[model samples]
Target: MRILLTSALAMTLAAMAWHAQAADPERGRSLAGQCRTCHGLNGIAKIPIAPHLAGENRIYIETQLKAFRSGKRQHEMMSVIAKDLSDEEISHLAAWYESIEITATMPE
Candidate 1:
């Protein structure tokens, strides 16, 4: 009985962790609407002030988001935007942007 209980608890924790790792691109797409203004079309924030987000790595995006949220990465606007985003929201957006079908075109 004790072993069974422990196994069950561990499995539950593992499941929760897995879900936490799950990033929903669909949800990310919805959340990204707010980012569209600055990031611009196809993740190319044609504006000089904004950084492009399309085609970035998933882990990289997550790390940056976490940093912005934690106030570790101080930027002119990123901190302000990330300050209010929930962990789940950040993860979702990361997934969406990371999976974007379009890549930004760099200027020569």
Candidate 2:
């Protein structure tokens, strides 16, 4: 029927839009070049003070980045860096870091 066809069309459009907006880890990896001095290419911190970002939850990373961008969380360096990031960029960075797989082991 016409109604069924219209509903299917609407659902297809919405799905395409969602897919277009999805985060891209490859783009995030490219963007992460800026973060490499402190955080390594793999999201592990190169500096003692910088926390490791590898395997961190995507939402948690997004939240912290947004907070830094908004000045709610104060980090002298992070504030300066995050201020220039767009929402898309934040999502990409989070995606890149979150995509990394890490395993933990207890010392025998």
Candidate 3:
């Protein structure tokens, strides 16, 4: 019984740690203010050069951001901006953008 209890405690602690490391949308929203010039707060692109970010897959966004930060993906502006972001910040930003809902319609 003691071993079972210890295992349960360990699992509980691991779950808590996982929750603590989870992405935070509110923090992402706050951090995303700097991105508003090109990518609107709603994740829609404000300028022709920027792609819309709203509803993009979190994994995809995270991958791209990391690539930019690592210099594997080269975009002068994005690389500069991503260079300062921590992994957690990238996760949060991806979460926030992923949370937005977007619909596409066929253009006539």
Candidate 4:
């Protein structure tokens, strides 16, 4: 009985941890629609003020997101936006963003 109880508790804890890590790539793609406004729908930043997301390294993206979420980096808009995102959501967004093809036009 004790063994069974221990197994059940372990399973329950694992499930909860996994729930924190849950993410959906398709949902991430849809979520990125909001990002399209400033960054462009194709992940291209129209102006120099913005950085492009497409084809960026996933680890780099995650690092930056963590910075924003943790207040290690200070950016008013980004912090507020990132604070609510779970690590899983960030990963999903990173995967989707990384998969986009990168291209930029030469400036005049």
Best by TM-score: 2
TM-scores, one per candidate: 0.71, 0.80, 0.78, 0.68
Candidate 2, RMSD to the unseen true structure: 5.2
Give each model's whole-structure lDDT. 0.83, 0.93, 0.91, 0.78
For model 3, how does the per-residue alpha-carbon lDDT over 1-108 read when each residue is reduced to its tens digit? Answer: 999999999999997578446988778899889888899988999999999999998879999999999999999899999999998999889888988999889999
Q: What range of 10 consecutive residues in model 4 has the weakest lDDT sum?
A: 19-28
- The most accurate candidate by lDDT is 2
lDDT per residue (tens digit) for residues 25-92 in model 4: 56668777767876666678766787998888766877898999999998877898889888888877
Provide the global lDDT of candidate 3 against the true structure.
Answer: 0.91
- What stretches of model 4 exceed 4 Å from their correct place? 1-24, 103-108
| Model 2 ranges off by over 4 Å | 1-21
lDDT of 1 at 1: 100
How far out, in Å, is residue 36 in model 3? 0.9
Per-residue lDDT tens digits of candidate 2, residues 1-108? 999999999999997577446989889999999999999989999999999999998879999999999999999999999999998999999899999998999899
Worst 10 residues of 3 by lDDT: 15-24
TM-score of 2: 0.80
> Tens digits of per-residue lDDT for model 1 on 65-105?
88988989999788988999998898888888788776358
